[model samples]
Target: MSAEGEQYGSSEEEDMYSDDGQEMEEDEQGEAPAAQAQPVLGPKEWVGLASMPAATQQALLNALGKLRGRNVNEMTVIFIGKQGVGKSSTVNTLLNERVAPSSPFQPENVRPLLAGRMAAGFTLNVLDTPGLLEGDSVSARGLMALRAALNGRKVDAFVFTDRLDTWRVDNADRAIFTALAENFGAELWERTILGFSHAQTTPTDGKPYEQFVAARVEQYRAAVRSTLGMKNLALPYVLIENGSRCKTNGDGEKVVNDKPWVTDMVSTMVDVASVGEGYEYDHSKAGKKLDPNNKHKIWILPLFLIQVFVLRPLLIGQIKRDVKKAESKAKGKK
Candidate 1:
């Protein structure tokens, strides 16, 4: 998608998909189950039906019928991440217009914001929730609220957001991903894509921007692959900067993201739309407590602090006392 320019938190900007907001639907027993697809007619075709003539709609369906293994109607994408990780910003970039509130301080109280009807034939809907963090109840509740709102509708894809500059995925990110797998079964990774934003920072003063980005991109890829044990599965991710303001130069490229990041983002959504099943929210698996009991979910900074304040000082004092005792014994023998 091409953009004329980019702005943040503009009073003029509005949430075009605000009407898509929905509350969690419960069954007779007050429980929401995993998603089970009813049928698909191809989202792009469905969205374009209203705008096209009756004859055009018939021709499009006829052509779609001839094409085999291309039955994707609508892609339901849910963005789960930290408060200011640019989830709304990424959605705005994808729509090529403001469909979300970009103000860092603004409250996105609406859940599951849907895009305006598309004549382009692609059906894409986005749902965003409050941030999730480990060892934090408020954060966990935010994530659960999002899952609950889906009301057992099958999800086409789940976009896990992180930054290009950061070298690590925090404990909360890991826990949430784990919960997804538990809810949807282990194949969840098959349909998952890691989105890396803030790519404008890749090119530095003296560094070769292309090579620098390539190296960092590989690192992020490796991290995800190792965690999922999908050594052979082609690592899925999007590299782009959606957080910064932009001005389109004479060329179509934005000041922040010059690459066709929006296109790739949407295409990636289409690519993985069929990888997994619609999932149910399992509270038992979500919001894992961050402590030593869960060794796999520990943060590196906490481990380092333990060494500096707990382990390292103890070792140093022990060594000093041993040296003094040895010297006294030698002097007495002499």
Candidate 2:
């Protein structure tokens, strides 16, 4: 597969594309309308939601669930991704505010930022984490802070991010997935959903956008399955198009996200929490070195330190530096 676009096999059923083909047929000028403010669910409305139609009810439920405090219960979710993949931007969008720091120049290395907002019967506790680097594992001390934030609540879902236009899975990506599997166990994959940044826009690749997206999704799915050595498994996914790129679609419309993507994101998290019966926060495995006695390999200690302490930090610094330089060059030329 090409470095720019990771290719994967096959296709599947309906996704976000099927619903907006007609709307996308027209190119809108300027930014898409900002998301409309969500209404708070009063006790009466909360009680009334049950009687509304399925779609409307779910939509409202998702909205109220995100609002910070309204006597609602909470579901905690951790956002995981390599740095600069729009994790912070997505988090800001979710909170309808700039709660998370984000910029195009570089990834934020800040510690995990946790906050809880409650409405009706839903409480959403979002933990925005530092980007995952190969061999860069969480410290036991960091996990302690995370567990303390939970107040004993289970982490319902682990949201992993990628660009919608990314078409290939690299070796580094595979390693990150393997680390996650080992830390959370093979079961965490069950509660995972591939959250795509820039969900509304697609890059031109000599083919239709939808076709490209389908292929990319498959490639990502295959990568995860292969990492886990499982041939028959599909990861849950959601797409949120949040970017500055203005592009043309076959529909002749400039790609713009009006808010459905965010709605879907919240709803999906709720579903995972409900399904998993709540994923508890467990960091006992943090800072774990490779087993020295594993039949899989011998002499893993020095290798572990090199991976975690030496190589990982160097890679992280170089990436951020490159991103900043690229952004600076683009600005100067413009």
Candidate 3:
């Protein structure tokens, strides 16, 4: 079979026609295939469909010929981490625009905010959260606000941001991961991607990427993985150096190298952001099916009428009765 033909087949057939088909067959029958056996479609292929014009839907179908895999739908990416970690910068880069503000905020300190847009008919929302250790008294309130913002929303993936140079095995990072797991459930860990920003801070020794990941500056990576019960604990992560500097010549013309880490980091962000394929966003359905317009609005009309006509009067009467009871109790106590 041709390569295109094989692309449209089951795993068994896809492997059977390949160079290591025999090995895959044996592994399938006796033991599970290695984790690396199944090739993950690259980030480019995943996002290609969404980037295509919707008017080309028929042409896309004919050219691709019955896509065997999933489709990208409404995706939400939440950036959670410490202060000054470039969460907003990463978000702006992924969006390829300045949709998110990057400058720091004071007073109450930087807090989480939600920004959304519709791209290629897919509604994409990215939530930028405040640092885990912003204030002492606002922890519970911050958590509640985070929950409220995420309420009635289906999160497809989370981008956990941390600083490679400033990371530490501290309570703040631990609390952040704990709160994340508690709120989103541990399953979200699998969908999580650790983004280590400020890679330029590392020494210019030109070491391998693997060595950088091994240094364990803060253990944020390991801590989050362990919290999620991941056995390997390495977890997939990306390193980025977002800050840039430029030098000017006599003519006041400036040249830039940008940040070397930016390329790889952007690639990884694209991958993490692309995971929302095949998932729909319908807040009314508890994350099932696309809501599409105000179709669900009709279902609430009768309930609203009942509340207005019957429940409201009953609720008022109950409030009056409770107030009388409280007054009687106060008198008896006196």
Q: TM-score for all predictions? A: 0.59, 0.59, 0.50
- Please rank every candidate by lDDT, starting with the best: 2, 1, 3
The better candidate by TM-score, 2 or 3, is 2
Q: lDDT per residue, candidate 2, 1-334, as tens digits?
A: 0111111111122110111000101013211111221212211112223333455445646554544343336566778878778887776656544456676664463345554544455656666666665254433322222223333346778788988867678877887677666655666677788998866654676767667777888889999998889776657788776554534344322233433565577778766766636665354543342221133455588789899999999999999999999999999999
lDDT of 3 at 322: 100
CA lDDT scores, all candidates in order = 0.54, 0.56, 0.49
What's the residue-level lDDT of 253 in candidate 2?
A: 26
Stretch of 10 with least lDDT, candidate 2: 16-25
Better of 1 and 3 by TM-score: 1
Put down candidate 1 lDDT per residue, 78-186, tens digits, no spaces. 7766667778788766555555666768865433444433334445566665565535322434544454544445666777777777756555555555554544355
Of the candidates numbered 1 and 3, which has the greater lDDT value? 1
- Order of quality (TM-score): 2, 1, 3
Task: For candidate 3, list the clashing residue pairs, or say none.
Answer: 71-278
Regions more than 4 Å wrong, model 3? 1-69, 105-111, 119-122, 135-138, 204-210, 227-229, 232-234, 246-334
Q: Kindly list the per-residue Cα lDDT of model 3 for residues 1-334, writing each as its tens digit.
A: 0111001122553321111111122134332222222422311222323443343333333322222123544456677766677886766544444434575662322334554544344445556665555443224434433443344445666777877766366665666666655544565565677777766554445666456556753366667666666656434677665564433234322212232343344345445545544222222322211112234578798999999999999999999999999999999999
